[model samples]
Structure formats: structure tokens, C-alpha cells
Target: MTNSWSYSSTDNLWKPPATIIRSLINCVSKNGNLLINVCPDGNGIVPEQAVETMREVGAWMKKNGESIYGAGAADYPTPEWGRYTQKGETLYAHVTDQPIGNISLRGLRGRVREGRLVATNTDVLICEYWNPEVQTLDGPEDIFFNFARPTAWTYPLPDESATVVAFRLNDDEGTRTERQRLDEVRMRI
Candidate 1:
């Protein structure tokens, strides 16, 4: 995805998690390219907003590029957290919004081998859910917990604008879901 693409900050007023990063992430996840425009100022220098946005994107990508570099669509729905990108055995969850509590993956039961917060490389626990969701993040011991146990331990965000959750899928085949671009998503063309 190409960034620092066209944005009308004057009239359009680009919003954050910045449109460029958001577009690049979502497009790459669907196997599409994002062409970022570098709109220059009067002096032919990029504006502070654009520069800062690129820096933020670069910072996030440095750690999480593994998820987006060779990622494709997974057999999953558009998550509230943001988007899903699959690279080989790993599924990258790009969480744009700051989640309040543990966000449950509706059909993600036993699908993940394990998870890590891309920003901090911190481990996030996963579990299979039910009336009393079975959380297996800690270890096998936690799996045997009685009914009414927390599904899984939640991960703490490390002050990132957009954090990616890298999930190593149990199956190498990855998700069966086909690559379908989100209707709301648009490429820079």
C-alpha cells in the first residue's frame, strides 16, 4: 500500500487512526494495494499532519509488518476491533478502536494456536467459549477451571494508535473464508 496519499485535510479533514494507515491495512488484508498520495505544501514540503501520520504508520508497521506484508483475507467477519489479515499460519487482527474489555471472537473457538500484541509483543490469552467460556491463555490448568470462568485473559494495549494482534492459527491452511473487500473500503486509485 502506498501512503501519504491524497487527503483533503483543509476541507475533508482526515480523521485518525489516519485514513492512509486504515486504508493500507484493510486493503492489504484483502490482497489489494493502497496508493498513498504525498500532497505537498506550498514550499513542496509535506505538512506536519502528514509527516506525523506517516511516522505513526511507520512505527506500527516496523513491529507489525509481518501481519500485513503477505497477508490475505481470512474466513472471518469484520471485527469491531478493526480488520483481519492472514499471513500463512498467522492471523493479524488490526484493532483500530480501543476496546474496553475482553473482545470475544464469535467463531474463534480453538482456532488460534496463541496470540501476541504486535505493538509490545505481549502474549494474549485465547479460549473457546460457551455458557461459561473456557479460557486457555495461561495454560492447561486454567482450562480445567469450573463453570462460570472467564473465557480468556485480556491483553493490555501499549499506548499504540493502532495495535495488531497476531494470532498463529492452529491449522496451517488458515481460515476458509474467501477474500472479499469490505464494501465501505475504497482504494486511492
Candidate 2:
């Protein structure tokens, strides 16, 4: 469910309605992908507001894309902020809004090896995992509140002013082997 807006007419040029963005987010939340279009003006320049909005979206995606690409519909029992996805033994948390300090996984009982901001090629940080025995997460709320880790890495977008970011989730046993087998088969052909 891609959300695209065209500036073919003046009435719609220069700005995409907020409803479009909201719908695109809804599509993403439902385990779908959004391919938004960024049309250039007659002078071949992107508007400044569009550029700023895209940057904000990219920042949010950089930190929370894991949940969007890796999680399933049932994985996120509660939707406090963003969507989520699960691949194999790992669960991803896609945060739309920047955390004030730290993010909490209230009902997660799985063994988490680590958690880190996506969109950057770096080592994954091994934070405290959820302990069923303890019946509570072992971490300061500030950690989740300040979830967005600043970095110099930037994602290359089709348009420099395009908004939106994405992340993937890596779980135990690595990627699914069946998908690998299919990839090998396609490559052979």
C-alpha cells in the first residue's frame, strides 16, 4: 500500500496533505510498505518544509525501523507509540516518536541478546532482557526515553527531501533458511 502524491495540478502542488501521511503510516502499521512519491517543482527544487518533514521521518525510522520490517500483526499487543514486527526469535520495535528517555517492553518474555538503533552499521548493544522471574523490566525509563542515538550516518533517499525511514530485525539462527534456499534457487536460474 504505497502512498504517492503528484503535483500535476497547482491545487495539490508544493504540499502533500497530512491525511496522506497518516494513511501511509496506517498501511505500515498493518505490516505493509509505503513508497511515497516526491515530485520536483518546475524549477526542479524541493520545498524546504517537505525536506524538513522527511528528515524528521527519517530520524524516527532510523531508530525504530526494526519493528516495521520484522514484526507481525500479533506481536505488538499494545500500541502506545509505533508499530512492530517479529522475525524468528527476535521482535522489532518501530518507534514513530522519539522516546523521552527509554522504551519499555512490558509483556516481552523472550531472551533479548541486544538492542540498538538501526540504519547505522555498528555493533548491537546488549541491554538487559526481560526476566519472567523478576516480572519487571530491569532498566531506567530514561534509557527508553532517550532511545534515539545520535549518529553521522544518513540514509540515501530517492529525493533528498523525501521523508520516512525503515529498519530490519535480526533474530537468533540468523535469517530464515527457507528464504535463503529460495534466494539460492533464483540466483541459479
* 23-136 per-residue lDDT for model 2 (tens digits): 445665576767667666678876565676677666655644554555455455644655455555555544454333334455432233445444553433222222222323
State how far residue 22 of model 2 sits from its true place (Å): 7.6
| Per-model lDDT | 0.58, 0.42
Positional deviation of 36 in candidate 2, in angstroms?
Answer: 4.1
RMSD of each: 11.8, 12.7
Q: Which candidate number would show the highest TM-score if scored against the true structure? A: 1
Per-residue CA lDDT of model 1 for 1-189, tens digit only, reads: 123245344544544545667788889878897766668666677777667777877876787788777788877878876888887778788877755445556566446566787767776644322122333233221211111124233435454456677877675323433222111111200
What TM-score fits each model?
Answer: 0.65, 0.42
lDDT against true structure, model 2: 0.42
Which pairs clash (backbone N, Cα, C closer than 3 Å) in model 1? 2-34, 2-36, 4-37, 5-36, 5-37, 75-177, 135-151
Candidate of highest lDDT: 1
lDDT of 1 at 130: 19
